[model samples]
Target: MKTIYLVLPCYNEELVIQDSAIKIEDFLRELVDKKIISAESRACFVNDGSNDSTWDLLEHLCETNAFLCAISLAGNRGHQNAMLAGMMMVKDRCDAVITLDADLQHDISVIPEFITQYKKGYEVVYGVRKSRKGEGAFKKVSGDAFYFLMNILGTKIIKNHADYRLMSSKAINALEKYGERNLFLRGIIPSMGFSYTTIEYDEKPRLAGESKYSLRKMIQLAATGITSFSVRPLHFIFFCGMFFFLISIVMLIYALVVFFHNGSIPGWTSTVAPIWLLGGIQLLALGVVGEYIGKIYMEAKHRPRYEIDKVIWK
Candidate 1:
């Protein structure tokens, strides 16, 4: 009799919260009735300070459903932070925890498979999307490119995996030890060195509300993942500096020779070319360094990842 917790992070998902709750409740009921999990297994929703009635709906569900629980964050502390808050609270109470978006785009049916994988000794089970049928071509292509770049940078993140996944109690304990303020769960999960497996499923369209992750958010997330886990971008800057430094020396030598042989030229092209190129390279290098510095500054603050403003339980 093992308890399981499904943690859903919500932000302004009023349109989808009720339906998602119903489906998750039904699934948990089936698992409990079939003896796959204890009756204590529950679905916990973390409301990320949604402006709408999302938290209210979650409260109503918690009142009516014995297996439903809800937590409201002090503010909209991003999706990853909210998920971290919920998981941290329930890790001791449950045998395993499954994290998913409130939109229900990730199939809830995959939970049973995630549980099966956990039973098979995999501490972490990733829900990898086999196909992005509802996403636009731009999103699909950009998503692919992001994972490719991360892999090339030595991050080794799972392809087609979002924040939807399962973590056994052992895995959750390992993750809890990582106290970095910038919580990139997907990037950090593989770093735990646990036995892991992937469950593939086709992504479905949102049942009710629009996606909370916009183009800007996606770009920001990619940047955070890169800066948080890999230093290859900084290394690339070093390589670029070395390359241009060699080129500058060659040009300087060639210029000196030309001055001794053919004298000086009238046009400013030669002077300006090196000036602009060197300046551009220097700025790019500084930018990469600044990115790392920014992360360091954030970590120095030692702020809590999330603040729980409220909690509702039966």
Candidate 2:
């Protein structure tokens, strides 16, 4: 039997930590009882510097539960960074690691399937949602748009898959080599070209408290994923510029012909309209280029992804 470690990244989840911890501990015990995993398997909760009493609750849980451990970041480092911190910390300690949300929205029941796949020689197992039946209207639309954009932009990723998945020690070690400042795990893992598989599972509703991913954060995540994985957006701007340049050449020819035939230029509206349109296009192009530049700048700085403030284990 392999030792499995569950890495859950949490931020401001005080409302659901205690209950979620109990449920997760029970599930781990059940898996052990069934001989699905080793008795030494552990659940590692990562505190992404939550302002609430989430870390305190984790300390209390760790004191009482042998299977539960905790990692606290120096400060809130976002979901991706916090998850990376926990997984990197425990990769050497476990045979495989499974990452999921602290809110229990990721179905814990399918975890056995992940281990089964790992045992069957799949190094990376992605937990893909079977359907978005329960998502809000805005969430559904935005999610659809993000995936659509990713597809159109030539980013190879498993649609409808979040950060919930299992990674064997080998796969996790391979992941540690990637030093992307703008981290997008969903896109990066597929690009690894490892022997991977997907498990379809139904996503459950949040156990408690509202979701931390607000609209701003969602957009930020999408942008990071896009800029990190695909250069097609930058190429798109170049193509648009070439297209407008061709149009301008044709318009200039028409204007010269009209000026020679009637001794006057084209209408003011025609000239002004294109000026305004091209101006806006120029600004949009600059903004897109700036985003890429910003990524390069951040990467050049070579900052640490996260810092661990404390860790607890028995």
Candidate with best lDDT: 2
lDDT of 1 by residue, 1-314 (tens): 77999999999998989999998898899999999899989999999999999988888899998889999999899988999999998999999999998888898887888889899889999999988888899998988888888889999688889988999988899888999888788899998899999999888888976899889988878888989998889889888879978987997788788788879844556587768878987987898799899999999999888899999976
How well does candidate 1 score on lDDT at residue 129?
A: 92
User: What TM-score does candidate 1 get on C-alpha atoms?
Assistant: 0.95
The number of the candidate with the highest TM-score is 2
Q: TM-score for each prediction?
A: 0.95, 0.97
lDDT of 2 by residue, 1-314 (tens): 99999999999999999999999999999999999999999999999999999999999999999999999999889999999998999999999999999999999999999999999999999999999887889899989988999999888899899999999999889999999978888888899988989999999999888999888988889999989988998899989989988997998899889989999885766677778888999998898899999999999999998889999988
- Superposed by TM-score, candidate 2 places the C-alpha of residue 33 at a distance from the truth, in angstroms, of 0.8
Weakest ten-residue segment in model 1 by summed lDDT: 265-274
Lowest lDDT 10-residue stretch of candidate 2: 265-274
The models' CA-based lDDT, in order, is: 0.89, 0.93
Q: Clashes in candidate 1: how many?
A: 0
Candidate 1 structure lDDT: 0.89
184 Cα displacement, candidate 2 (Å): 0.3
